[model samples]
Target: MADAAFTQGAETADRGRLWVVLYLATTGLVLLLMMLAGLWMRLAQSGWLDTDPALFYQLMTVHGTGMVGIAALGGAAVLWHFLSAHIRLHAWVMGANFWLFLIGVVAILAADFPGRFGGAWTFLYPLPASSQGVWPVWAAALHLGGLLVIGVGFLIWCLELARGIIATYGGLGRGLGWHVLFGGSTKDVPPPTVVAATMVAIVTILALIAGATVLVMSLINLAFPSVELNPLLAKNLIYFFGHTFINATIYMGVIAVYELLPRITGRPWKTTKVFLAGWTLSTTMVLIIFPHHLLMDFAMPVWAMAIGQVFSYVNSFPVLVVTGLGALAILHRSGIRWDLVSTLLLISVFGWMAGVIPAVVDATVAVNSVMHNTLWVPGHFHFYLLLGLLPMIFAFMIHLVRVEDVTPRGGDLAAILYLLFGLTFVTMFLVGGWASVPRRWAEHLPEWQIWDQIAVITAAGVITLTTVFVAMFLARTPAMLAKG
Candidate 1:
């Protein structure tokens, strides 16, 4: 009976690994396409290519929406693989989510390309309706409908994950290590579980509801032209949803680091009282911090804006003090080999930390009033997403594939080039932002063209190096899996 039980568990693990591979492959593909779309927009801005303004915005919409979904999927893949080790999750549920997300992507493409719906990814209320003959009302409805389906899929996944955690660990507090935080027990909770629990708890309630509200309002407005919605209310809900969704990506990435880094370093990153405290604080701050994005809205209450600044300031401490310090300590003189996973994960910590600095600065009311609409906004997020988040996603994938050697051919060069160009590209945006260069412009003035030109070049290099990295992984994956 014991042997049979062990065999059953092994089968479940195999199934989980298979799904993780699928998720990673799909995410990489989507990211590649989205990167190209973003490059096209930048090239147009640099005067290297002539693109119609409408087409430029359509590409922007696709890039923005698609990249967020891809990032979420990459993070979810990491969490799903690690969490499956501790709890039983239905493979079919994850598979359904994947299919729904793909469908939504296709629907978005249809809305943007043929239908010419270019309201941007936020699909902010009234803009979809106010497309001014750029797109039909039905196309707007279809776009929102796709998003609604995606939201429903995400909601269900979070709900199932929440349910599984509760059933396996007794309750949310137990799973989240609240007992340890309160000095009640230092028992069985692991850091990854705390991440999973906190993320699921916050996102299940906040992101899904915020997403549903915006999508529903969009569909209603599309269906009933007479039914108008408050613009301020819609903006608030949409940004709340957007902020929470992206924030959840980082949480999942951090959870992956917690689970995978220890294995590479031959160290045990056990859940501690302080670590649990950070996550608990994160649960509250992440939800409320959305207000920082809306600080430019003079109509928004001063109290909410104040809350945004305060929480944004406080939110930096956990990642910097706890996760960053803990990672440094783990890597310090551990005799850890600088393998692909280790190298990428270590750099990802820096990327995340550096990205947060700019984000925190921009979150300040004074800086935000000037920088919010500038290229600096993209500079910070792209730094975090491209430098911080993508590397973590790749590291997790490499871990799953189990590359036997630390040194894949050309990997060292690829990593160096990727970092060099990615940093340079983002720096250009930051400098441009500092110069008050506007964002979301299809064309740039002569004064801004030099920055865009440098950015386009650096971006191309970054994209090329990323392709090399992906290609290296693909080349190694077959051999690694065969060995297994």
Candidate 2:
């Protein structure tokens, strides 16, 4: 127990912290850019911006690509820190992983400018393959190539981590992670969650491989001109990749919760049991939920739909039960200190809860009918993304950095204001979604105009509140970086 802190190596913290700082700052830059694009999109639709769709798609494409690339796999670089610091693993391959990740991000961004690939990040076929006799098809190929390289980087880092665990557990009968969690000697290995993370990495590798294969084929067809595009195969491959990749971030978020939540409140999570079991559950169920994306398309059979919904409902249970509620349990047991990280964690729980209700209801055969493509879809995602993943990322950033970690003196007031702001976003999205308001629409029917106004007003509130918070953080960040 005395060595628990040291178990997370000292030098690794400094090294890992730099990566975290880069990741957090880059992610912030991406979000700031996205919000600007979103504002522009709003303006253009209202005829306020007078922008062309091509340029709009360029910004949107970069924004989506950047967020997904980092938000999803940023944790790949981060996993090195988790291993080296907490598990006392070697860092031989960490920097190498970062280099590859950077290469992929740079390549995709370069190809996305107006000349080569205005295909948008979705790369939604046929259009991406053709130029309208205007732009060449090579642009699509370039984007896929970038994703391929990033996937390779993720796999290499995972392998390095697994090897470290094997080294620590040479003769021990217990799992490596079990040894670490129970306060075993330096010779003992990491706990179950860490061990499960290796397996999650394996799943991510396969999903990406599947996606890259189909994407590459589509690109190759452009040159070959005779290759057939199988819609079924393409859809399956992309979702398999998309679902797993997005969930990868959630996996890291979950791990962070188990590791950091207890420490913040001076709580002990058995350091022994829940961490291992919870992650094991996550590894198993998460694989089955990918089919939910296909539910909107009717090409699949009823059995497929039923099975998808069932698994979709079931898959998130582990996360909702073990990580979400469990966080509060530990905090309740330990007494809440209400720090910035703690506040983010608390909000993550609420966000997860918010996502779960609509999601569970929509999973039902009856409700899925009304909620399938409407504003309800956005309703669920905002809660999931804004409340769940976004806050989770914020919590991770705080833990991963050294910015005083202080909430303002009036943070409780800030929390109330922020919560109301988020709720406004959720509420408007729900109203529009229920009214069958089509999303990504520039303007709507006269009846929908009121909902649109509500949406704009709420979104404006969110933008205002978020900008304030961001400015505060940015103000502090330069000083924090200066310290380093």
Candidate 3:
């Protein structure tokens, strides 16, 4: 009987590991493809490639949508893998989400390539309908419909996670340690992973709902030309959804740090009042801070703009400080060994913290007036996503395949190269913004091409190193899965 039970447990573990492996593998492949597309765009802008302007916009649409979508999927895998240890999760829900995501990707690609839907991923209202005859109405509808499908899949994923957390912890509030924070209960305070997952589930659910509303509304207007939407309201909803959804990816990816860092340092990451407060504060602030994206809209109300600027300053600090300080406290004098995974995890914290500096600067209304439409916007996001969030995801992938914690030959070299080139790439964007270079233009002036040319070189380096990392993971995955 005992042997049978042991076998059953091992099988369950293998199944869970298999799902995670699938998720990471898909993420790595899609990420590489997206990076290549980005490289192509930079090359075109640099006059190194002679791509058509229409094709440039199409690739841009795919690059943006693919990167954001895959980030969320990868983050969900990390969260699910760790969070399952503490709660009961239905693995079928995860599998379903993956299939739905693939279907959505197919629809998006078809709409963009064959159908020529060049509207950006934001699908900002009326833009899809007013493609100036460049794209058909059906193409716009299909793209919007594809986004809705993706949002629905993510919504289901978050709901399942919420269900598991609630069942185990008694409620989302308890999962976030609201009871411990307010009721002063010393027993049963959830760990850092649970706290983070709870926050993600809450925010992602809300963000997806907002995204679905906007997508559906846009689809309706696409089919029926007479149905008009208030552009201001559409922008608000879209930014609220887009900003929150992307931000949640970082929050989800950070779970890898919370779960892995303690193991590396031989310490436990406990949930404290400070940690709970930080997450709770962030939950509120993240929802309201989306308005900062609309500060340039003169039609927007004064009160909303005030909320955007004021809360932008406040929101950047809480969870970051708690997580950053917590990691430091754990690593201090703990004699943690360094490896590719551990090194990347540490860099991720720094990247996230540093990324906030530029984001906060842009969030300020006065500074935003001049810099809102420049490469500075991309600079800020790429800093956090490339250096911060992607590192967390990559570290987790490397962690899964490692039989031991020792760094492989040249692992350190690869990591250092990634950081060096990533920093240079984003810095060029910041510099371009400083020089008032506009973003999202397929063609560049001769003077601006210098920056684009430099970025092309740095971006290639980053992509080559990332390819190495992903290749390593793919090669070792079979052995790791078999061991499970």
What are the TM-scores, per candidate, against the unseen true structure? 0.96, 0.82, 0.97
Clashing pairs in 1: none
The Cα local distance difference test for each model comes to: 0.82, 0.64, 0.91
Which portions of model 1 miss their true places by more than 4 Å? 1-8, 479-484
Worst ten-residue run, lDDT, model 3?
A: 8-17
Per-residue accuracy of model 3 over 108-211 as CA lDDT, tens digit each = 99999999998888888888999898999888888888899889999999999899898889999998899999999998899999999999999999999989
- Candidate 3 or 1, higher TM-score: 3
- What is the Å distance of residue 462 in model 3 from its true position? 0.6
Deviation from native of the Cα of residue 130 in model 1, angstroms: 0.6
Best lDDT goes to which candidate? 3
Which stretch of 10 consecutive residues in model 2 shows the poorest summed lDDT? 171-180
Clashing pairs in 3: none
Alpha-carbon runs more than 4 Å astray in model 2: 1-13, 45-51, 54-56, 73-80, 88-94, 116-120, 125-127, 130-135, 169-196, 271-278, 364-366, 399-406, 460-484
Cα lDDT, model 1, residue 387 = 87
Candidate 2 residue lDDT tens string, 1-484: 6587665565566666566566666666666666666656545544545666666666666766666676664455345545555455544455666678788877777777744566655565566677575455566667767777777776676666556655655422234244443555454444535554664565676676776787687768767877868776677777777777766765655555666777787775543355555555556666666667677777877787776788777767765676656676787657676766677668767777677677766666677677776778668766666666666666665555445546666654554566677777677778787887765554455676665555556667666655655565556666776787
Between candidates 2 and 3, which one is better according to TM-score?
3
